[model samples]
Target: MAERLTTQQVAEQLGVKVETVYAYASRGQLSSERAPGGKGSTFDAREVAELAARGRRTPMRPNAAGEPPAGEPWASRPVTVRTGLTLIENGRLYYRGQDAVELAARHGFEAAIGWLWGLGSDAPVTLRVPPATAEALARASAALPDGIRLPDRLRISATVAAALDPLRFDLREQTVQAAGAALIAGMVEALPRTAPDPGPDASLAARLWSRLASAAPAPEALACLDRALVLLMDHELAVSAVAARVAASARAHPYAVVSAGLGATDGPLHGAASPLAHRLLGEVLVGGAVPVVSDYLRTGRPIPGLGHRLYPEGDPRAVALLDAVGRLDGGAAVVAAVAEVEAAAGPAGRPALRANIDLALAAMALAAGMPAEAGEVVFAVARTPGWLAHAVEEYREEPLRMRARGSYTGPRPSEGPERPEHPVPSSS
Candidate 1:
């Protein structure tokens, strides 16, 4: 058995007061056991000596400026990461100093993207996918397994497109913007199309709509879908955006940055939220609202489309998109079902729960007669511009700067031999 030492003996060996020894035990730096018959606690001599030895060998490490960095994980605490892109304030979102809601309402999705990219609103938003590039992306995407989701197919296409772009490593503003536009256009054209292409001059919404729905969409439905894209363009520093920035910080090519964002968006709680919300909206559209709401609530899961933490007063973007939905033909059933569901989900005092952007996208998809997963496709395409903009921003900063520091909680490097895998044979 390892030798044991009384608190006084441990304190003397370590040149610390007895109280300091007690503090070490309390802090788990020292292991102690109680003695029988009201005797004082004693520490394992081996443990105490090992800890002291580690302390002596390990010198304090501070930076050249002589200040030690914080040890706590930033994830558990609120941290300020500076970015001038999108700002969420007073329950409203702003993209580069313009109100996001107003921008979505008054301008096209590409115009809002220009603003995020530091281009003046009057700057032209280009959507031109070179014929050769589009063909290559199509061929690559077509080879993916049928069971893969649309976003995964886009990710694969991104890889192939990046491989083809010789100037992909060019971090200049004009070059990055050109690459971003071609990538978005290629992704849209590469998506499996059902309805006829509205031609090259068609708006992005028109082009993407053809791929998503078999039937033609009403003009108002196209407007609503376009607005949804604008609203989703940038939400200041989302998880996927952070992932994109991390890649950009490493100076990864723009297509690679978007590939990173797409990878992060594949998570259920992030970009995939729209599809789940789409499913709920479909059930409500097919079944009556009350029964569907009851059945969904009975499962003890929060309704997917309702409420967002950032918009307690209600998501203004959702309000804006839903207003456009109101203008759609045959939109009453969807609007009414949404209203009944919202009514059934009466708030319990905290500013009143409201439908979020996911619900808005789902409503738009349903009203436009698109498939349940179409909302996710729209989200991925819409967010591409913002991802590239962030990549540009990251390229100007220090490389590999977003790395996280971890606190050591595992076995120490100086730890003595671990317990034997098989105890030494009892030499009886």
Candidate 2:
């Protein structure tokens, strides 16, 4: 029989308290078996000796500010959640092995959706809002006050659609695709239209333009917006997509998954970036780029739309969409302003700061005479398809597989709330 060491022996060998030995066992750092005749738990003697030599018992100490040091690299580790939707690397975005930039320029958003939805490139695409669904969204949205934000209006409309869809709970592949299309279409049709309807066969960009801006439909501007939507469709493991997947992992109905995604998108650091960037662009146009950018830097705030962490060189999506914007009428002025901001806001001696998709989206809206808030609406709507795609993937996984394990740091069950044994001795 292999030799074994008692808990006390193991603790002494590792130079930690006995309680720490128990803690290590609880954490699965060391395994033990019940001792013969139930004396106590015993660990493999050889394993204990190896652990002692390795000095893993060195207590993890806090920094000067009392913050604990970093632990396991769970956040950055390469764990798998199989997806072929979009790949982001070297500042480029790809959808299921095809270049996103090329697709945006060559095909409109419809073809891109077919690719993302696991359908072949030649699959027929049809997206439509049922007349009843549109009417229901309109009535639900009309009940809200006029000042409600566009995303909030979208949330209310989505809830209405969920309530109306009788087959929303169906998780079959075909049912999911049908439900996703209706949800996206309802969101678009519910937006208050300012221009005349562009007819049923119009591209989503054209339909959305009527709702967002009063400017008459120009083919170039509409095409620019279409490419923007296609490019923005999906980005792997983005926070909002993770939120949608988490909901879907719980087998949530399609509408619930979308609602979860929309909730994450409302966070200022994410979906709101476009509107903030639009405002920054307006400020640069009015106040002169150099002074406005210099002022923003002095305040220690990130210059909106100037840099993205994921793209060290630059965002390819921004490059493609901004190029399209530059090709549109009256786009040269916006391009010049963008160039000025890039030069002025960039850090000295470092690589030139690169513009991100938010910058490109803001520039597109400004050049096209759309309202600043319209960019945020566009982002939310464009990202809906990607969220649904993640939802579909999550549906196939075991329920709650994404659930996280908590490492409790609180007092043990035996150690209840502190109470002086002798009533604190009547401290005066």
Candidate 3:
């Protein structure tokens, strides 16, 4: 064997997809060798390890105008996106200088997920739960109501129960991620199904559709939807995932942790908007696009199908998904109608109020014959992997319950040891 290894070998050694290894090399975090004949590259194992040892977390991001707050405004240390990228700069989306979209597309969902989780692979993290704790979670899961829907929600409860087994706050990152995955899988599988079996290649969405309704989904479109999972997998500190991480930090059981996530997800800001967008589409069709756009513009109200918070330049995910969905059966005309309506409406800074990824997903899911309620389920299912990955990340960095502060806006309402309270005057 030579003293050094090629880039391909380095990828094999690291157990990451090839591009990820190249990403590390590209970022100068991994050493590379110039080939004699051509443009190929190689790596030295010793050099790679040395560079890794020196590598560290120092998050850098653009603080562009109108960017959202990371809270803790008064704190000296501004939070940086160490493992995630937010607010694209100079037409680039980078997670530590690795092109996120390219990586996501090339390596599949799990690879991108691995990078987020700190383990950097599809590597399994198995925890040997003590018999006592295991038995306790089993009993609790059994005791849950028979008819309760939502597999992920049940897992939230199960994780909570599992945590009560007294081994929940384990510090290792792999342990947390693996345990969460296992818990979620159990909940999904255990749900009573009344439909045809999802084969090995069937996606979580495809499986969910079959389980929720007896309706079958097309194989090709379902695969696209599966890749859609990869696209939706992570965004920096989304509202629901924030709630999830907060709960995890408090040592909530995995079930309880994600339950907090699900609760937050129910709000209009996150999960509910997709269905609303769907309804808005229906209204636009019924009311006629011109009239609807005219009225909406007059009121200066935003249209549902157009625009997003993160992508002022346009959501890359939305662009990719819409393009992918365009290939679906009967997709083009429907998409064209929606696009025309949007272009007619989006003028000035509003930009035809272009529909984001959620709208496109809803459209595709509808075309695939999913029920009105199914989009949110698909969103939740896809997003959980990322949320749990983040939870594992947060768990690794700090000890439990990282003392989130709130503004004390109320009047000085305090009681002394003697408990001096304004006596209530009773009118007799």
Ranking by lDDT: 2, 1, 3
Which of the numbered candidates is closest to the native, going by highest TM-score? 2
- Candidate 2, 1-428: lDDT as tens digits: 77889998987877777877776677677789999899899998887776665444344334334454332222211235999788887778899988999988888777788888989657735779888898889888788888888878888888999999999999988899898888888898888888888988887888899988786678888899999999999889999999999999788999999999899988668877888889889998898898888888889877888777788888898999889899888787887788888888777886668788898999998998888888888888889999999998888765655656456799678666777678656567
- C-alpha TM-scores of all predictions: 0.78, 0.81, 0.64
Pairs that clash in candidate 2: none
Residue-level lDDT tens digits of model 3 in 178-275: 66655544444444454687753444445555655455656656556655766776666778877877776665655566667777767656865666
Measured on C-alpha atoms, candidate 3 has an lDDT of 0.58
Q: What is each predicted model's overall lDDT from 0 to 1?
A: 0.81, 0.83, 0.58
- In candidate 3, position 240 carries an lDDT of 81
Question: What are the clash counts of all predictions, listed in order?
Answer: 0, 0, 13
lDDT of 1 by residue, 1-428 (tens): 87889888988877667876776777677888897565898889888777677645544344324453233212221233568899999998999889998988888877777788888777748888988898898787777778677777777778878888999999887899999999998888778888987989998988999989888777788888899999999888899899999998777899999999988888767777878877877787788667877887789977878888888888998888888887887677777767777866765564435788888888888888888788888889999999998888887764555655467899667667569788898889
Candidate 1 wrong stretches, greater than 4 Å: 1-80, 347-352, 414-428
